[model samples]
Target: MSENNKFKDFFKFGDFGNYFVRVFQKPDPNQKSNYNLRMMHGINKISIVVFLLAIIFWIVKRFI
Candidate 1:
């Protein structure tokens, strides 16, 4: 596969894209907003951050 195709294969699933999108992007104005929704998204962002840190730590521990 070409370099681009290989890179595309790595991200073939959109889970990673959705994760970053949900964390960094602003909420859609057209979508409904409420206290519970805000809290849910907030918690999701925190979990994503923690999960990423764990992955990084694992890689570092493995290398070291």
Candidate 2:
């Protein structure tokens, strides 16, 4: 196999190697106290809320 094929095979599993996969991964308890992790969690929560609000707005706008 070529170098490209080897790299492809490493992540061939569906969604297994996707960029967002890591975002859904469980946080390590050991790192829970880290400031960076706390900040990341806050960001993730805000982003999710914003995304949901955007979807709701789009639906309402579409119907009305």
Candidate 3:
């Protein structure tokens, strides 16, 4: 099999993009509200932010 066909099995970019938007955007109005799910998303957003910040700090510390 070609490399393109092999990579196709890894992930679809559209699904990844949709997940990022779903995590950050307001929940749909028609959907039922769930406090636990909301809190989980909130925690996820915080962790992603922290991870990115740590990466940036590490890069800067390495260069300077």
Candidate 4:
């Protein structure tokens, strides 16, 4: 598959439900290391943190 196709497939497969599954899946020692996986995990963590912070800020704004 071409690089562009692979990029599209990533989104198709990595939709929200699959994302959480991927995030919680156990690491395999035998599998070759993948840069994409690490990058996705980092993005997931950052997204979750940012979302939580936004919610907190919204709540505080409502109270004040």
Candidate 5:
């Protein structure tokens, strides 16, 4: 849990918009691994994509 490792995880997870990579991430043994954790991450990733798309669509519809 060092600051350096946190920085690495950010890029390792694919910067920002590519959060879907969590679906393919291997569970870290050091932390508690379970279905709920993985499922939550997957759902969160999907939400992020959906939210971004909605924002883009809204902006396009409003201005163009």
Candidate 6:
């Protein structure tokens, strides 16, 4: 499928992306906080992995 159609289907799926969009559509402040928390958790996990990879690369470079 084309990129546009693939993106359209992504929002249609009953998953985090759909739920996240629904939360943003609301006017509730609590929903916004929940969304932020979920996003932060995802970022934190990614950051940790990236940091570990960087450390491993540095260690390997030092020995080479």
**Highest lDDT against the true fold, candidate:** 3
Candidate 1 local lDDT, 1-64, one digit each (tens) = 6999999888776887867786668988998899998898899889888999999999999999
lDDT of 6 by residue, 1-64 (tens): 8999988877675675465454444356554456777786677667766887999999999999
Query: Local error of candidate 1 at 58, Å?
Result: 0.9
**Residue 9 C-alpha lDDT in model 2:** 82
**Sort by lDDT, best first: what order?**
3, 1, 4, 5, 2, 6
TM-score of each: 0.72, 0.51, 0.70, 0.52, 0.53, 0.47
lDDT, residue 3, candidate 5 = 100
Clashing residue pairs in candidate 3, if any?
A: none
Poorest 10 consecutive residues by lDDT, candidate 4:
13-22
TM-score of 5: 0.53
Assess each prediction's global lDDT (C-alpha) against the native: 0.86, 0.76, 0.88, 0.81, 0.76, 0.69
Give per-model CA RMSD: 2.3, 7.2, 3.5, 10.0, 8.6, 8.8
Which candidate would rank higher by TM-score, 3 or 4?
3
Runs of candidate 5 with Cα error greater than 4 angstroms are 1-30
Clashes of each: 0, 0, 0, 0, 0, 0
Which prediction has more favorable lDDT, 1 or 5? 1
Task: Pull out the clashing pairs in model 4.
Answer: none
lDDT computed for candidate 6 = 0.69
Candidate 2 all-Cα RMSD: 7.2
- Candidate 5: C-alpha RMSD after superposition: 8.6
lDDT of 2 by residue, 1-64 (tens): 8999999988687764453556666766776367887788678767877998999999999999
Q: Write the per-residue lDDT of candidate 5 for residues 6-35, one digit (tens) a residue.
A: 988776744553545555567678988789
- Deviation in angstroms for 43 in model 4? 0.7
